[model samples]
Target: MNSIDKLRIVFMGTPEFAVASLDALVGAGYHVVGVVTAPDKPAGRGMKLQQSAVKKYALEKELHILQPERLKNPQFLEELQALKADLQVVVAFRMLPEVVWNMPPLGTINVHGSLLPQYRGAAPINWAVINGEKETGVTTFKLKHEIDTGNILLQERIPIGENETAGEVHDKMKDVGANLLVKTVNALANRTIEEIPQSAASIEEVTFIKHAPKIFTETCRIDWNKKVSEVHNLIRGLSPYPSAFTTLDGKTMKIFSSEKEIAVPTSEPGAYETDRKTYLKFACPDGYIYVKELQLEGKKRMGVDDFLRGYKFN
Candidate 1:
């Protein structure tokens, strides 16, 4: 145990992704003095109040928790200041006002989904897979004025399987990210780490930097005009949430998993062929994408064979 054990810390996060990091900190016996998370909101069919995953975990741990409607709220600021945290850790949370981030003596640190200086946006995990990258990783950095433009403290690289979905990568990265976050905190506490500016020469050499903006409805629609690989990547990248979709019988059908065939296409892009029993494949520029898992609008998710059995194209 180093000075970090005695440091008063505040952990801020929301969502399941953040929970793992928080849990790692707690499990490591960090002196977490406070927890801040988003407020409860209505969700689901009943629109009942739903607690954020962090909030629920905080409640179970019986830690001091804050759910401020606004970080700049005077009352919230007063309470936050009272915690007197030596450092604050943020993961998978909303952007913070400088006043909030600058509150602690050691300043704030964030666990970003990307390796930094690349995929710097709201949807790094999804975009990395969507762009067909074979490698993606987690980065921990000191927070500055710009979003994800912070100086790097530590990073851990991980490979993305060629055929893996975004959800699978997310699952793997969350645990890997949790361990890295703990390592970063320990390094910072022990005064053994140095900050590296993101614009350092090594990062600058990458000329074709890609940005990961938030995905939208238009982005999720299958562009059959693209090559089979691109189309396949898009489908896997968006799986399990905000899934890729295409029109079927004038109704929208979401694709969750797919297999690509690189043979020359016989039909126009977006055209499909099905024996109405075993397969449903759509043509693209270079080949066809066989829908392996999917769901029709207003229907439960099912395998392609099951979907083909019940779905009657008119």
Candidate 2:
């Protein structure tokens, strides 16, 4: 047997974004002993129990699965300890207590969505795009007491395309992160990795680091008073999830994709102009945000032309 085959691994994650890493490890001939994911919960109009994407993939792989309602449950802990995992890998999972994260001999490692010392939080991809950053990447780090504050194991940086939505960036990062996680695991098994402290960089160097807190309903409300570029970024950053919104005709309108018009606007910020056939746009402080994709309340997502075809502004 290969040396890597002797190192038992346990994976913890809950979403589609994490399936890539778990799949990569199994494909690479790693001995992933078990998987822990969120419990199936009711979803959709019919309220059927929906399994998490990671759990679905794990079930297909025939891997041992655990879905504990509470992380601190004694039964779950007993089962986890029974796995005898040499190391643990986490991606898109909830916070772990010390007993769990510290149980593995080689320690638990996390594949985070952003580079260290910046964009540290639950919604890194959304925040990076919303803040108009030119670049962001993935980081694999050892788990510690503080969230996302651990010794760095490996990282791979990627450029964020202009006008790209957070959903787009998320899709790209998942693959990159999967490859990097495999590399990190191989290096760890070979004892070739050197852990570096985040504080190794001076405070002056990382002063611009930003936090990526969880986005809320209030957070997605569009602020037309801002510059067109800023408003555009906000819309794309939240696209397809907690999407940026505004009220039109006293009903909510969700904006998905938009183009910016930088010419000085004739109308006040928050004011909208529509030709009732071709375009629907809102003015900002500096210019206009020409919304190409949007959804009106009680309607399906459609292009501006299609939206205009069915309804006329009073």
Candidate 3:
């Protein structure tokens, strides 16, 4: 495992978040022998085939790319075996089969978006914001049979601001994850790191575990029955992506940013109030959520002031 021995690395990822980790590995002089990403699928209005973010970047770097439609395909497996990688790195990617994850000598190391044993599923960044957590961070762990149920390698913590949206936190996590991946790889090369199991005893007296399931349209719909702060956090959690939505004049409106109003509202829950001049506020179980940024159905996103100038929520 000498520094110049050229440890063969394979990277598995699909989205922009994973791209940061891949770039970091390349910049650190790791021998990224191949990349495995999702197959190109039809997307957009024209239904054009689109390559994944990871594939695009791998091509630019002139690295070998593997886009297997099925992980169990014998042909794909053979190609992966031919790479003869020493380690694999996964980031923001799909669940891997045991054969794929266990193929390498040093095993696969995953770059998860949140602290291990917490937010351990598909959408960690969004769920952390949705749950209104004060602090969240990234973790590197060895791959196991279960998703995100691997032994911890290294972790770096970051604070989540009260007013921050999931998108904001996502960008910050990307950078933090890149740096952590570099450190983890260096430690692995030197055989100086220890893997800690994620059982209850391994954590430092933390009990509750938060889950990060994939977001859906149903989950993103604004639940006005919750407290104003809760609803506000939901909006921020899904912002700039699978944004929180509500019905406005029988049309769907996607909410990106909101402010909580603690004052008791005279209107019933789910009711909306607007100055018809510059602000629109929706009543929740306890108070109101002042809409600051949103997009009405078939309309471009706009600020509260601009949205009020043309459309009145009558």
> Quick one: best lDDT, which candidate?
2
Candidate 2 global lDDT: 0.94
lDDT (Cα, tens digit) per residue for candidate 2, span 1-314? 22697999999999999999999999999999999999999999999999999999998999999999998999999999999999999999999999999998899999999999788899999999999999999999999999999999999998998999999999999999999999999999988999999989787868877899999999999989999999999999999898999999899999999999998899999999998999988999899999999999999999988999998787
Tell how far residue 230 is off in model 3, in angstroms: 0.4
Clashing pairs in 3: none
Candidate 1 least-lDDT 10 residues: 201-210
TM-score of each: 0.98, 0.98, 0.96
Query: Against the true structure, whose TM-score is highest?
Result: 2
Residue 116 lDDT, candidate 1, scale 0-100: 83
lDDT of 3 by residue, 1-314 (tens): 53524889999999999999999999998899999999999999999999999999999999999999999999999999999999999998888899999999899999998988899898998999998999999999999999999999999999999989999999999999999999999999989899998884445534677789888889999989999889999999999999999999899999999999898799999888887987799998788999999999989999999988999556
| Model 3 bad stretches (over 4 Å) | 2-5, 200-207
Off by over 4 Å in 2: none
Model 1 Cα lDDT, one tens digit per residue, 1-98: 34867988999999999999999999999999999999999999999999999999999999999999999999999999999998999999999999
Q: What is the lDDT of candidate 3?
A: 0.92
lDDT of each: 0.93, 0.94, 0.92
